[model samples]
Target: MWPFTKRPKDPVLDPSYGDPHRKALIRALEKRKWKFARELLNMAADPDEMAFLMEAVGGVDGIQDWIGDWMDAEPESTLPVLVAGCHAVRWAWEARGGKRAKYTTAAQFKGFHERLRHAEALLQRVLAREPDNVTARAWLVTSSRGLGVGPAEARQRFEAVTRLHPGHLVAHEQRLQYLCAKWSGSHEEMFDFARGAATAAGPNSLLHELVAVAHIEKWDATEREEGNEYIVSDEVRAELLTAAEDSIFHPDYVPAGPGWAPRVATFAMAFELADEFDAAGHAFALLDGLVTEWPWQILGDPVEKFTASRDWVTTNRS
Candidate 1:
């Protein structure tokens, strides 16, 4: 028998929720087996599933190096070009970094826009072949921001996706980014968009968590104590609880594969911020130690943030 090796007691912070299919696809790509990746994309049950899998593909480092071979091998397939295009959009942001414009070098900005245009061209080709393609259209929404396409054009791209798949979570998330204050919007616009989308998506829809996301964004943009006050305000706390009930806590609500953790994480963080320890504990109980990097990482190290918050809820909850 092998030795029993103990693993570190850290919460595994994964954006993909350690999804089995995502793991398989990444392993296949690392082995240069594009066919396996192709099979995985083809097997996605719906547009949202496809988009979720494709986003994972796009984040694979150096996919640009060999994805062209997949494109060449499957000339008739839109999947390769779609995969490559999404990667380019993510690649564009990699060039831009996550820092504000003033902190970025001119060369980084130049590379950023150049890659976005390339991503646009590739995505456009995919759309030409399959106009109703939600994944390609969603990436274009992201590229529109990097390319400085006016809000009008961005809205058009987003509407195109909605016209096809109304409850598209990825597109809604991307559109939320476009409506953020750092982009072409104000906090008012961001909140308006978030509330409208959440209401429209209705009960059992993950989009309801967009309300939690909006609160997080506003808090992140405000001064420290003031942000905490805003999050813990009675009005905000009530809104978050209502939104959570409409989605995560609803009787019919079910967690979808790979996309479940982030939505729950958003509510968990929101409850923690609101100092609603009982609700926060309930959210963490649902998560059962799973973690996503966003709302938590926005405050501090994701694992540490998750551990601290979970511990606090355990200690303080009635």
Candidate 2:
């Protein structure tokens, strides 16, 4: 499951699975702190934190059901609309098929399409009612990509959202996925988007993250033997280092509360793939011990792989 079940509570829940950021989101919803929750989420300046908020709410099946209650409680609030759309698109992402998987049942693909369409409808409603809700628009772009609406169309959706709320991390990353060659977007286009987005967003912003993600995804798209050497290239290496300086290593880099961990986690993984364990160690240190499923799960057994990667880095550091 792309959006796996919530960290299981039974049979001795792994402490490593207890993400503070995810906990905070659930707590906000449970306590009905709509304004506080939304305000807290708005501080997320990067894709890492944004993804955490989106996934924490959207990954679970029950969130869509909860959206009705939230809407009922705060009928005029844009938060509910954003949450509703985010949950739908995120769930649809899990259901959507990809070449990486050996098999995806037709039923699964159908469910994916249905959920994606539902997400699209919900976002459209949000836009119609609250025309300037950029988060809803971002989710709309993501849902559109999942629905296979084509990269050009997705770019239009993304650009429309950014025009309203510039430097939207989710919108940038979603468009990156839309532009991937595997999805019919070329490598050249993806890097250009990443670099341009980072440059536009400026330093100390997590927008540089697009560079890291672009490199990793492009590597995956290429042949394994050749791709293994992709990170070693002078160009890719230079971009990743610059991205690091502009974001994570910048003096003004702020964690934005518990949301900071994902930024570190993502950066660490990028460094790991680049064979720069020293840099990876810096990212891993910020994470403490909390590892998210993604970036690592992109390889295998998120927990195991993360722990092993950490151990290797630590050992080499000594």
TM values, all candidates: 0.93, 0.82
| Residue 210 error, candidate 2, Å | 0.8
* Tens digit of per-residue lDDT, candidate 2, span 90-165: 7776776443534777788898999988888877878888887666777787777667786678778888988877
Best by TM-score: 1
Cα lDDT, all candidates: 0.85, 0.72
Whose lDDT is greatest here? 1
Give the Cα RMSD of candidate 2: 6.5
> Which runs in model 1 stand beyond 4 Å of their true positions?
1-10
- lDDT tens digits by residue: candidate 1, 254-295: 665647788888998989888988788777777767787766
Which TM-score value belongs to model 1? 0.93
Residue pairs of candidate 2 with colliding backbone atoms: none
Task: State, as a TM-score between 0 and 1, how close model 2 is to the true structure.
Answer: 0.82
Model 1, C-alpha of 63: deviation from truth (Å): 0.2
| Model 2 worst lDDT window (10 residues) | 1-10
